[model samples]
Target: MPDPCSAIVHPCLPQNIFPLFAPRPWTLNTLHIIHRRAALARLLNPSLRLHAITYSPFSTTPLHISTPALLVCLAHPCLLGFSPLPAHPITTWHCQSPQSPPSPSRPPCCHACSPAPPPQVPVERWEEAQFTWEPFHQWVMNTSVYRRAVHRNYPMSYPCGVWANHFYKFVFIRNRKAASTTVTDNFDKCHYENSDPRLCIEVVSLNRLKERGVDPAVMWRDYFVFTTSRNPWSRAGSSYDYCSTKWARTDGPCRQPPFSAFSRDPSILGKISNLFHCFDRVGMYHDYYHTEPVAPCITTETGLPAVDYIIRYENLSSDLPEAVRIINQRRDPSLPPLPEPKIYWKKKGQAARSHEEQGVESNTAALVGHGDKYHKCGMQCVRDIYEYFRVDFELFKIPLPEADPAGDR
Candidate 1:
């Protein structure tokens, strides 16, 4: 059987034409003329099979011509009997069925054929088909809250203020100086079936958890998350006093330095120099008490807030129980009520006496009075401290303290 792709000739072409061309020398020029005529014949009747006639002296049968030569023949009109070809030319014709439809893998005829136009797609569908990163990139850029919270060194980076309780299927972000120890301790007791309230739950850092094969994405999705925020100025003062006393007991360079000396060394030459060097000796204190914005800690990968609730440390007495209720409802509605946190005065030694002696009725009043000593050096020093923690004030909706414009120096 002939090859499936071989050209076919229409029966209308004279059968005797093959013998006239068979006797000629089969040179390149002779072959070209045959191909040209065959191509023209194909064009005239696409249904026709056009073949090149070639003969060897030893055989009566014509040699099989290549498909390429036959295709080239389709290009010349004279070969199709539209006009007379050169007398020396040899041409053969065969009667066979017209070629079958081109295979799916192969394109149809040469220049005369074109690919079908691509299937039309709806505009919305096309847009959706494209993969673009702009939306995701924008979300990442909008994580200003997370960025601010991590600006200062904390124990953890990704989950800045978070404390996880796997047993309760919840995570609590304990803001610095916001009674975190109390909150975390209560969770610890709950985790151990209330066996030992003082077991001290270890607040794991996000990075460390990841290193241990815990995926943050999974944790965020599976756990109920929450955080607390405090009044920035009050928190700042409390942090300062806490760090001062804590460091005094240690042999650290910043130990026991007066807030005035700590803010800026009087002997520092440049104006901005003192500001930069302000917390150098007590860098640990600075890191621990830095402005931790709540947004970053609770933000999802899409830059949306991920926490189920936010408790205000200022109203923690009332707010915490409500937050606990929400968590319990989501996890196991039958869980027992959370124990009330024991409120303890954090001020110890001189700081405790100072607050008592001043007869300060509120934490805010006590912190402001304690923080006032730092301002003795100059309002600029206080301004510098405020600027360092400016994000905390802005994020938590706390008002900034009034500054003396003339005393910026």
Candidate 2:
């Protein structure tokens, strides 16, 4: 078949008939109004027998192009018509079958040419379920709040790669200082933009947004959401350190100075730990199963639930594969793959270099403030996320490893 992208332009005749003198195999079926005059001339010519529209009635005029290049005229066909003496002059021609023309009290027009059918689904309900997850996976990875929390807490990490085409909704309610960046990067890598108008859309979040006058499920319907969390004590310190960095900054409350310095005195740290825990005091001890879950610090602000997936900063690499597998089992193949999974790190002393190369200086107060608030808000977010989703930590099958607090026991 000839490529339609390189078709020729032409005009039509008064009778709305197209003429073609050449004898050859032609398959063109439709024409636009602009080229109606030229197309009509071709149909009138005797040598070329225009192919009538398929399933057309007897005496119905047949129209076909002699060459594939002739298809351009179909882009803009002209229609003329006229009524009797008491009415307006009619010069409109039915581009479609006149026998089944559109309403005439209005402008004389015809139905838009039918477009080709979409690709067939491999299976009925099964296919729908699979494609449902692609958008869901995308929603999970797009949360800025989740990504910020992950990058701040984890040492070095990146998102996991997409393993398969199928996926369903994913909800990632990031906890303070978890490996959420890795997950975010992976989501960015998975899919490409699609122009199709039929695909479903969904939204994923760190927490539910309903109670705050936002419905996450409805807002993200036909979509997926996802997020992660961190070990509480470690998360608190990481949040504190990140806020103190003076390089990464955002708007939020409760962020203050001296972020890099962890005061040995718990009293001093407690003073500033309103939303999140006192990192300086809790940084060295605390475990999830050993203690009751802490109340969320920023739950009122974001209206997000705790995390659905409480990914431990200590076990992200091992735990990520299962998440990918679940996604693959649910979505369609057209969605993009997640980015390659790896540990991403700010090189030692590289933050200053980044700012220098960009010809900009990092603001000490701004960066520190953002980092501190991120954790304080993130921890509460994760708790609500997990509770809302009813996702048990056992599904991740992550085993905690022993830690050496002194750098060498």
Which candidate has the highest TM-score of all? 1
Q: Candidate 1: count the clashes.
A: 7
- Put down candidate 2 lDDT per residue, 1-409, tens digits, no spaces: 5444234333322232222312344321112111222233233332322232222111113344455223222333433221111111113243434355345432333443111111111121112223344432332244222442221111111111111111334444333345555555554323346622222222222232332343432322222223444434334445444533332222243344442233221122323442244334333122111122222311211222212223334445444654555444445567654433564422212333444466643322112323333244444433332332222222222233343354311
Query: Counting only residues 3 or more apart in sequence or on different chains, how many pairs clash (N, Cα, C under 3 Å) in candidate 2?
Result: 80
| Deviating ranges (above 4 Å) for candidate 1 | 1-161, 189-215, 248-255, 258-306, 345-353, 356-359, 362-371, 374-378, 404-409
Clash pairs (backbone) in predicted model 1 = 8-49, 9-49, 35-73, 37-79, 39-73, 39-74, 146-296
Off by over 4 Å in 2: 1-168, 189-215, 218-225, 247-308, 333-340, 345-409
How high is the CA lDDT of each candidate model?
A: 0.42, 0.31
